[model samples]
Structure formats: C-alpha cells, structure tokens
Target: MRPQAAGDLVHLSAPASASLRTRPGLVVHRRRNLSMAPPHVVVRRGLTVTRLEQALVDSWPTLPPAERRAPVIRAVNDWLTTSERLAVALESAPKLVDRGALRTLVARLADGCRSPLEIWGHEHVFTGPGMPAFRRQVPMRLGLRTIYLDMFAERERVNIELDGSTTHGDPRQREIDLRRDALLATIGILVVRFAHRRLVHEIDAVRRETLAILATRRPGVIA
Candidate 1:
C-alpha cells in the first residue's frame, strides 16, 4: 500500500488509542453535536446562557451589599400618587399596609381631605377640636369580624341598642329585645337601650343618658 499524508499518524496498538480515548473529555470533541445545548437553554439580547450567567454572577456583589428598611413615609407618598401606581401596581401585597398602619395612614389622608366627612356621613365622626374621638378601625383578621364600640372609645365600650318602634310592634320581638339586653349585661358589657320614640322624640334626654354612661369611665370614679 502507498504511504499516507503527513497528517496521518503511525498505526499504534489499538489498546493505546483506546486508553487515550477513555481519558476524561478527550473523546468529547470526536462526538459531534455533544456540546450542543438542550431545548430549554435560552438566548436573550444576543446573549448565550454562559454569558448571561456570568453577567449575573458579576453583579452579585452590588445587588445585596447593603440592607435597607423601606421608608414607610415615602412609600405611602409614592402610593398616593397616580403616576407612581405603575411602580407598584403588580406588587399585589403592600408591605406597609396593615390594620394599625393603614388606620394611621388613612387618618393622615383623611385629615387633609374634607370629602371623607361628607362621604361617610354622621357616623363618620372625627376627633373634635378637643375631644379625642378617635376613628374606628379594627385589626385585620380572618373571616367576618365585628368592630365593637370599644374600638372607638372605652366609654363607648358599653353597647347601647337603640330600637325603632317596629321592634316593639311585635310583642315577641319586644321580649327578645329584653332578653338580648339582659344577655349583653350578663357579659359584663353594660347595656342601656331605648325605644325610637324616646331617642327621636326626646333626643336631648337620651343624649344626657349617653353622656352619663360615658362619665362613669372618667378618670376619677369612686368605684
């Protein structure tokens, strides 16, 4: 047979060639398409997975080198603005909005706006010039929770049921109302109720009674 070109190597023992082939990664190049990536591998902005991963790794030091407690005041202001809405629109859960914090935030917002008053009506009582008539807000909890009068004022903690004439129209309902008041009283929450006639026809007298109940809780009670 004629001699082969210079690139051709001298024939060696098959065992030697096989041993070299078995060396780690030596045969990898011989296996065509072995280095080709899997289908899940992705490219973005002309960057390959290797390049993207490298970029992310390099940015790691700068990404979390500092700890920051979010600025609550500034966060509220940012949320208040319509322009900033997009910044946090996708952030479904607000970090600062909780029962106590939300109430405090709303109180500040309410103080700045007159519309809140007209919109919520008479029940929407604000802290008067001197009296600390705090707003009623309950802590966020699961399920249908009721806000007792205590949430507003300790004096108002005693539940006072004001019934309409229709309540007395039915004798059975009147008895139920009496029983309800007694039950409430048994619970240690004082119950003083009044008919609609007394409440509407003699509002001043009713007001006096309401004030008296509140007075009992004043700083110096003989108890």
Candidate 2:
C-alpha cells in the first residue's frame, strides 16, 4: 500500500467470546484475553481505541515488510510512543512476523537514532572496531536554542550529521546547516556531515574517514 493513501481495510479486535463476522472491508481478530488495563483502551468520541504502541504492534505483521518500519519510527520521532513501551508491547507478541527485525529497530531507536539515515549509519558506517561509543541525538544548549547532534564523540567534541537525501541540493537547508555548524564551533565543537548517498554507497570510506577525523581530534594527536 502507498504510504500516503489510507486503505479501506479495517482491523477489529474482539474477545474470543464475541461472535463478530468479518465483512468486505473489515478483518476480525479474536483474542483469548483482551486486556482492559488502564491506558490500553480508551474512550475517544464514544469509540474505544487501542493505545498507539499496542495498535502498532498488532498491525505490524499485516503490513508489507518494507512498509512496517516507517510507521513505528515516525511514531517514536513524533513522541506519540516510545521504544521502551513498544518493546514491552512486543514482548506480549511472541508470534509476530519479523519480530527480530522490529526488535532491532526498537533497540536502535532507544539508542537515539531518529531517522532512517541515522539508523543506516549506525548499522553500516558509524559503528564497529576502532569507533568510539559515539552518543546519538545528543543535546547541546547554546543560548536560547537546544540543538541535537546526530552522533557525538564526547571526548573529541565532534558531531556527525547524516544528511538525508531530502536535504541534497537544498540551498536554504545548507545555509541553515552552515549557521548551526558555526554556532557549534563557537562552543569548540566541530560539526562533520555525510550526505545520504555516501553513507549508503561508500560505507568503508565513510568509516575510515570518521576514524581518521576522530584520531586527529584526540588529545595528544596533531593533524
């Protein structure tokens, strides 16, 4: 299904005791125990709806593999749900399809990887031997603004930004990034950015360059 288009199909969960029949556009899911725990189900406009995390987990397997991650990621990024809560919800679903992959994504989210690009960098480019345990989504308060660094090597005071494809060729965004970098530099932090293409296609080179940069920033090292 296309991401922007809402499908007509609706999934309804009912207790095993309920005799609900699926219609043309409806799917009925029968569960032995429909948890009525507080916050699990709430009355909204006179209709009961499952909580965001439960709903996401329940509907995960039904979605095409490629389409599952974005919704969960967006929900986490928007503050609608958290990776911890999602992990708890996932624990109850031992039979979930692609459970391992979903669990891995949630773990990455808990590590403060916000976007797909950041997650990609975490898996392929920014991690492994010789890499410092860089902090992800680190917050730096500068005057009135709180800027979040994508990946930060604390000792080196270096921030790595994984720029997504959407930012490519966008002059306005580039200027804003430059200004932010300058602002960071004022506080003695160096900002390094890698575009989406290089992070994905030139994995080895990116890793090497990141290590080299960190090496130069080490306390006793000279560039």
Per-residue accuracy of model 1 over 81-144 as CA lDDT, tens digit each: 3212322321322432232433333344343221222112213222233233433332222235
**What global local distance difference test value does model 1 have?**
0.38
Residue clash pairs of candidate 1: none
In terms of lDDT, the poorest run of 10 residues in model 2 is 1-10
lDDT of 2 by residue, 106-155 (tens): 99999999988888988888778989999998889999999899999999
Maximum-TM-score candidate? 2
Deviation (Å) of 206 in candidate 1: 1.4
At residue 55, candidate 1 shows an lDDT of: 21
Q: What is candidate 1's TM-score against the reference? A: 0.33
Q: What is the lDDT of residue 221 in candidate 2?
A: 88
Considering every candidate listed, which one attains the maximal lDDT? Answer: 2
Q: Can you give the TM-score per candidate against the true fold?
A: 0.33, 0.95
